[model samples]
Target chain A: MTGPRLTPLAASLPDTVPFVGPETQERAMGRPFRARLGANESRFGPSPRAIAAMAAAAGEAWMYGDPEVHDLRAAIAAHHGVTAAHVVVGEGIDGLLGVLVRLVAGSGDRVVTSLGAYPTFNFHVAGFGAELHRVPYRDDREDTDALVQKAREVGAKLVYFANPDNPMGTWHEAGVVEEMVAALPEGALLVLDEAYADLAPAGAVPRIAADDPRVIRMRTFSKGYGLAGLRVGYAIGAPALIRAFDKVRNHFGMGRVAQAGALAALADQGWLRDVQGKVAAARDRIAGIAAANGLRALPSATNFVTVDCGRDGDFARAVLRECIARGLFIRMPGVAPLDRCIRISAGTPADLDVLEEVLPQALRAAAG
Target chain B: MTGPRLTPLAASLPDTVPFVGPETQERAMGRPFRARLGANESRFGPSPRAIAAMAAAAGEAWMYGDPEVHDLRAAIAAHHGVTAAHVVVGEGIDGLLGVLVRLVAGSGDRVVTSLGAYPTFNFHVAGFGAELHRVPYRDDREDTDALVQKAREVGAKLVYFANPDNPMGTWHEAGVVEEMVAALPEGALLVLDEAYADLAPAGAVPRIAADDPRVIRMRTFSKGYGLAGLRVGYAIGAPALIRAFDKVRNHFGMGRVAQAGALAALADQGWLRDVQGKVAAARDRIAGIAAANGLRALPSATNFVTVDCGRDGDFARAVLRECIARGLFIRMPGVAPLDRCIRISAGTPADLDVLEEVLPQALRAAAG
Candidate 1:
């Protein structure tokens, strides 16, 4: 017997699994990871103040948080040197991306992103039935000129680019980003994701004035701020675009402890710097380990290091499987050229020690 | 210049405010509430075990939560004596409602709810461009007969009912709800909201079969579990209906600490029993206060008590305003007949004392 009818688009789509959590894999494999370095999480953890704040606020989870998120928004405004009107906080950058996609791109509305850039963003576009124009990355960096040209060719309304990009962890400097922003077609808007901007070098993230209507920048507490699990993120843009969020956003969605934890995380800059330092060191250690295993490590400005296996995608995938088999949880790019490299997040040295020890064996197994 | 265009439906709808959170009123009043007896938050707080679990999880806030919510779902399944596939967790009941509406009702699709029922659910329906056919409440309870007739008339795909009703703090027995479920139209689905079910008396919430395709029950950790601010809610439904969420849900939306806390909270039945007892005691105190003020308090199976103001919506509104002005922060329903009462949440004895002291003066002021 027939049950319920899904929307035409939804009916056509398969009930595919989007992502499998580490726990699921561990359960399948009958073992836990020796090094949890996949998914680009900041294993360095959040600031002590943030942790303290969360622990203290833990008892107050009974009450619903303020829907407007005033204090957090105000703090974000102060940090970004913008008015509170310019910011809209959400569950995470992932959540904001979904809302932005729904707002700007409707059924078959053209949206542009680099091929295999951010799967989460692509997932949202697909959810709303947006037609995608996926440009290939040039030399592991998003090809700015190509993306702009495609956006204009298709009259795409929303363009997504992440500076200090994920999976590969490469970045573009402010000047190049500003140049691309200027090239945006009239009526089109750029969604510049700076989720990893804090870990990048100075001038790596564009210092756009928050009032700019042509673009919006997305940031998150997930990566450098070290509160990924708290699910807090904000976007900075013209008030017009920012206010549009209220029209569609889940008003009471933000977690109360998460809000308090994020505010404290933002206030403690010293802890962020300390985490950043640890991440940088971890990246170097990963690179060294890769080199010792006769692989090339991509230069990264973000928290994870992408190691090139000096081989094809199949070989790299085998390497990934071997590593996972050995209980070193890591991941790789899904597309060609980039797929020849496996991505590993920065972890504590002890965690990295497992990675270093396991990689050599995994490489040998892959070659065999 | 115009920003991104809202859909034609969104453009036509008025810019409405669904809720005025207590924080908003406190900001307006320039002081904190002495008795935070509004919004029906559990003043009993979460279980001590949940608090400890959350506090311990404070350090791991940097990692993205398990998108699958595997552990929590397993625990919920075990507790309910059902398979994990029967449960789907979300931001809150509001979020689950949004997903359900999206799955079934598109533009102009007929959906039914009680007039002045959960505004958040209505907000979601409007957001999705559904045609809402609202049946008025029957004697302070959602009218099951009227709702069934309207659904048949409209050929509605979805019908929403909240048992142990909000604002009025009223409920019907499980047998009546089961009858309502059986009487629903073929191919139509019912959203049975049991947000306050735990506090409800025996026979208040029906035991629908786990695989009942036509019925989906909504529950939350917000009321009895005392974690509204943490934003954890779930739905129990047939796997076919539940799996639809995977197509569009923000997979990693739930916070890790929140997941852990909710799991721990659900495990501590003793704490929940203690809270239930406290809530029952507080309800008695609230009724007594209403009686002293010459107002009849409606019988409540929920955390809040509704004091009948002995007139239409207007007089109760006046009482609500006075309470707000005096920093009491109590709320009343926004619509007719039901607004004939002011809603006050269960709070501590100290909090109740403040309510007891201030409410009479507010009632006197409103009488003028």
Candidate 2:
């Protein structure tokens, strides 16, 4: 290659997409999807106030956003009962996760995450050339005991967990999670991903003290707030951990409109509650439909419902393809055992109607 | 620390602000700048069509951006006469620089740049634990010969230069830069930042083949296209260099609204030309104003004009402070002898009127 040689790591890694976005898949399939349920997006849409705020800021797209993210951080701090120093907002939780991993992990350092958890987190670890230890979920929930054991055994510097997790909407109670936090080794830091916390029931979110430094929690406006396309997410942690981001972060990364849209989304609690209600209703509709099709829907504390296919991974995959063929965009776990199920995100009533209509035909075709 | 332990490289790094944003300073002073010219943002905002497109996208803020950035990359490639594989869209030049540095420069690797060149590039170098070699500019233009020599002397893996550079609106002719590229060490990559290329004079932007594997050129909508706050910048290079970004980039980092805005902006070449004309006239206005203030503005091929302060760094510092105190958000170079100049951006006639009205007062106060 006449181009500059990539550092050994970049040269070695393959060009891979973490998830095939529905848009790309639709393009490949030469059509649009009927029911948009994959990617865990809130089809209920963003807060009306956020949309209005974004429209208002559209013309002022010439000035850079506040690099400190001052206003948004202040609101988030007040909401969480923490100081603004405890928060760091970025492009999204994915962006913040990349920064956090860069802050701590280097080549050869060990980082732990549950296998088949959030691939984006693992992607960040691999991007930094860190070694990742994957502990398989126990009975669909991330095995917290296994995670702590591996962290201690490997002397990992960071361990990642998500409450009310993705692909499989399974979670442990707050007490059990607190026990896992207690078991983390002295040198190990926990990344508690609460991306779906808003959709999860009360008490599903562990109420850690605002000043706790052992764990850094990531939350996003993308999920329950329905602002995924706006690209806003934040991390809350010890002030020191938050400040370390300044050393390497893209200082002007956030778009001005996004910051404004997210602030509006955060402030409009009524709209958020309205979306949460819709999401809950959609989740029930999906579970009910899944049950009617002879599959068991996993109890969910998140926006998405995971339905056990009552068959194997191959059957589940065939079912997924059938759904896609019928214009439904749904997904399943990438790994074994967990792949025996399909994950469907909460959506509008019309989107669910499309899913309900397509499910029977897709299942019959898969069976055929 | 109870939080994550930073890696040795990250720990050694300092919490440094590469450039204090004009916004931060404005908040500190509890006032807004009357003439906002410091950040090189086009006071002439993006096209009305681009704004309309982003506004239309406001409702779709619930969906994540296409991870492949397929449409935006295709549009950029078409605009630049290259294949889709030749370009990668990112948050901005700053974000792209962070990725490129990570892809090529590892711990203790050598990278070269002009001493007072783009500070964000240097920040990335330090963030990655790379050894930075600074070559002082020859007469305010990045000394091409000295940069190549430094690269060879230190076996540097990366060398950076910005055409129509910032902090000092000085530029090297295309032929001179082409010669510099020809003289680069075999293994070193050239990062040609053309962020201001569209605003430059004739023959300033080189006609290098997009497939040239030895160099990667960066361009942004933030300048001539007047979309700075939108945070869209792209790198055009050989397929190899572009593909390397896929390995570590936040695949979904780019915002959906930004992608929409940039696509519309690129398609509306007429709007671009109109803005370019406005930029030229403003540059002239800024120059004439500087001349009336007893300071000679350097010939600029950029939106910003660097006025020679006719004294030492301290005098330029005083001039800058006086301008800021008088509500002009102008900036100056960080290192001598370029520090003997203060940089002012091209703005609308009304914006220039403010500068014209304030310059004499600022000068008088600085002298006292």
Candidate 3:
């Protein structure tokens, strides 16, 4: 009469989501939020051409999507000025992280990442029974040198660092990141998550050779391209490393509309440029609102601005709760120091108007 | 410099796709497929309501899909007379199979399935480093009793059985399947893939209780709902087993448009019934065509018919090649006994007209 047996690794794992989506919160709250700016998604929607492509492809959904993702890969390769051999498209950076961890790290193998960076990466590493080594951020930025040193010390199989980083909205110059890449141990692969690369200032993303076997850079259409719901991302690496993904990935996991939409999005660089300008304006507006509320906003190069509440973790948590209570969906880091800051994604003017009105009230409520 | 090191298990695995999609073949041939009947996709297309829903949601593709899949799960639960707790939606059955295998069977764990039943399932088992013990089909149908015996003998953690099976399109009565479920070995969970259940005849699918812990039934929108490219599938089981998926699944894997499309498709069951009728008629037409070509068409409960080529595996392969060369897409099983048959999907009138014109020529070419 015994029920099914979960593997010991799975049984030991916690039942948790890396991030609680805003939709789940809305359901729990029994109402939708007035401002949705928590997940770092682009407030400006995708290009009209991309939307048209997706709508046009809707009826053709009767056929399975191309398993190889041929066209999208080709376009991504061309965009990066590389050949198709260096690209591997997947369900998103989240999906690709899972596959990447599974490919490199086995049970008990050591991996390194910045603490409070991205929970999804930790989740994947833990799900695979790999040992995780965390390095703390230095001055609100990912400590790349520390990460590289830790990997060497632990004989780590993989090391993860995100440029134009999440949570803190800080980044290192391409030259600094290039030096860190050079410092990577021979056996350790550097997973350079460039999810916000498109939004970063020039020279923030390193111009590495596409065939650099020591690093795999991941880019997504979710943020700057405004197609978060489509779940399309691609990894750029050596041909051999990229091809290894073929061994374990669910080949047909990419939706047909997703492929078409991403291809259309990639084709419209003008839309991307316009959105970047909009995001910059939105970020300045968010910072101005924070300043008006007597909060210090951290300098940001990405789509989001991290505001320092100038308080402890509990105080920052209270501020976040007050914002959520007022229907402003904002989030904060999960750990100390970084937890003292509240993260806010750049939203449209209307969305920011709601935020601007609520932040003062939320701040007063948190102070009380 | 050395590249990333793959895990021993990943290194040991072969870099091969379980099914070579027709799209890949078309790319190789440097042309679009004239008749896409190789995969058993619903050529009649999704419910117009579903297509409209997807198109409408296309503009809102900036928001991430609900990770909980709350509304769709509730709708699926209502349809199956189960609670939301009994359902877990995923990125197609292929993706779910990978997660299920990872959860239940670890490296060196035993899993049982019919040989050549589903290569995708085998792919997942291998990807997880699990040892698979396959029981061959008997009389061109999956031998459930033999599978049960093998599971018991090997102490298998999971056993996979597909009702209204793929490739052969043969099925057993509900009572027989129920008996097999009851006979499942302790600690073994039966994975009943009902991908084609909506098209199955009465008594072909068992009326199992949703709380049955010994079995997890998987259903897909790809077949009957005609949304193959959307990649939505759901697994039904006891609340405990269903919730286990949350431990390891990609939370944001399901696309927003896919959820909307599936919800709309489920609401329009009338469209489902109409598609079923069309599939039935197309199946009959395919059988008639086979008979006229001096081939024996097997009894089928699913969307495709398997025609015995009156020869061996090589002859069947030659016929399949001829069909492809004549600009018609058809497929055949890859293993022995079943490899002697060529499989054709039910298509629209226009698609069938192309098939009717090309199939006879294919046979003649094969004979020569």
Candidate 4:
């Protein structure tokens, strides 16, 4: 009649998830948000061709997706001017991070990242019972020098750095990133999370060799490609390193419709350019709204704008709560300093209109 | 620079996958499969309602699926006569099994299952660095008593038993399963994989209390519900046991289309009943096909039939190769005794016509 005993590591872990999705908040409020500007999801939908592919693939839902994910991998490799051996696709960047962590870091292994970086990465590190040493964000951007120093000091197995970073949307140029790759401690692999790569300005992405063993870069269809719901993300690294994923990954985890949609989406680079323009325009609108509210919007190279609330974490928290109460779903960074800002995603015109109407009132309510 | 160092446990693992998907075989063969009966996917297809839902959801792919998966969980709970807390949905049964193994069994922990029961389960156990103790199948079925005895002997943390089992397609009634649950050693958990439950005979699925902590039962939409490509599977168990999944799982791994399609599929039980009838009829047709070829089909309560090749593993392997060479995608069990058989999934009448034509030819080729 007793339950099975969880492993010591599992028992020691908490039940807290990495992020509380907006759907969760909507359920709690018993109503949907007027603007879905959280989680950095694209308000601009995926390519019409991708939608058609997914719709067509839906009827073929009885067949398991190819375990090797052949066509998509080949397509992605060709797009990047690399071979299939250098890329491995998974459920998403989150899923790949979990697997990569498992493959490299055993219990008590050292891992490094920015303190207020992606909580999902931290979650994976802790889940695998690895010790995570986090350096602070230096001036609103991930401090590459500090991260490398920390990795060398700890002899860390992995270092996670998201370029054109989430929450802040600040980015280092290609040369800066290339230097970061060069600075990786011996035997310490850098996990370059370029989830927002498609939305980044030209030259923001580095020209690392596809066979670079010191780093594995992850890119997602979730951001600019606008298919977060499909859960397709991929990693590119040395063939040997990429091959190791097969040893631990759920071989047939990818969905058939997801593969089809992603392939079609990748093919429609024109649709991607359209999304990029729209996201850029939306970013400016968000900045304009922030300026009108007497708040400063950080210069962003990604799909979201981080509005400095010009106060403490508590004030930002209050503003976030107020926005949520006013039927706007928004989020703020969890740690201090970074927590002084509230993050917003690119939204449709109507959605942004709702934000425009709500922000002033929300700020007034929070000021009280 | 050198690549990242892998954990000793990960480095010790091999690159061998659980199953070679038909697509991989097709690629090697330089063609498509005429009859894809290897993976046990429902060629009968998903509910029309589910396809429609998935198609509609495809356009909404910009949004990440609800991380909490509230509605689908509620629907699955309602279908199973349990509360939402008692059910936890995941990417697939394979994905869930990996998480479950990580939750309960750590490095060097003992787990028990039939030798050839399910390779994917064994893969997860190995991937997690758990030591697996396998008992042999008895008379082409998983030996429940032997499994229980071994679990007790090893003080195993987990014991996996697939009812209406895969590959062999033999099953035990509910009372036998209840007895197995009662016989679980102290602190040992039973992973009851009822992936084929929807196609099983009445009373084959044991009714255990929702609060039973010693056993967690998994069911999938991939088989009878005919949505393998959608990748939705669920486990029912005590709330605490189910909650542990949140500690380590990829929180937002399930796709939006998958959730929507599964919800619609659950609502259309009539479609499921129709599938059940079709599967039963197909099973009979397969048995007839095997008789015509002078082979023996194992009695099955599953969507697939395992036909004993009437000779050694070499003969079955040869027959499998012949079928594959003829563009008939099928599989054989990996372990001996069971390896003396080739497994075939329920396919469309058109697909079965190809199987009927190919099986005899394959048999002749193997004989030569």
Candidate with top lDDT is 4
Candidate 3 chain B minimal-lDDT segment of 10 residues? B1-10
Tens digits of lDDT, candidate 2, A1-368: 55558888878887787888888998998988987899898888888889889988889898888888889999999998999999999988999999999999989999999989899899889888999999999998899999999999999999999998887998888988888888888889899999999888777888776576679999999998998888899999888888999888998998789899999999999987887888888878888998898889998888899999888999999999999988999999988889999999888889899989998998899899
Residue lDDT tens for model 1, A262-297? 999999999889988999999999999988888889
- Local error of candidate 1 at residue A221 (angstroms): 0.6
lDDT score, residue B59, model 1? 89
DockQ of each: 0.67, 0.77, 0.79, 0.83
| Superposed model 2: Cα runs more than 4 Å off | A1-3, B2-4
Q: Rate the local accuracy (lDDT) of all candidates.
A: 0.88, 0.89, 0.92, 0.93
RMSD of 3: 0.9
Q: Give me the runs in candidate 3 sitting further than 4 Å from their true place.
A: none
Tens-place lDDT digits, model 1, residues B72-111: 9999999888898999999988778877787778777889
Model 1 error, position B175 (Å)? 1.2
Q: Least accurate stretch of 10 residues (summed lDDT) in model 1 chain B? A: B7-16
Give per-model TM-scores.
0.98, 0.98, 0.99, 0.99
Q: Compared with the true structure, what per-residue lDDT tens digits does model 4 show for residues A6-115?
A: 99999999987788989889888999998999889998999999999999999999988988999999999999999999999999999999999999997889999998
Task: Give the lDDT of residue B246 in candidate 4.
Answer: 93
Write down the RMSD of all candidates, one decimal each. 1.3, 1.2, 0.9, 1.0
Q: Give the C-alpha miss distance for residue B114 in model 1, angstroms.
A: 0.5
| Residue B214's lDDT in candidate 1 | 79
TM-score of 1: 0.98
Candidate 1's displacement at residue B222, Å, is: 0.5
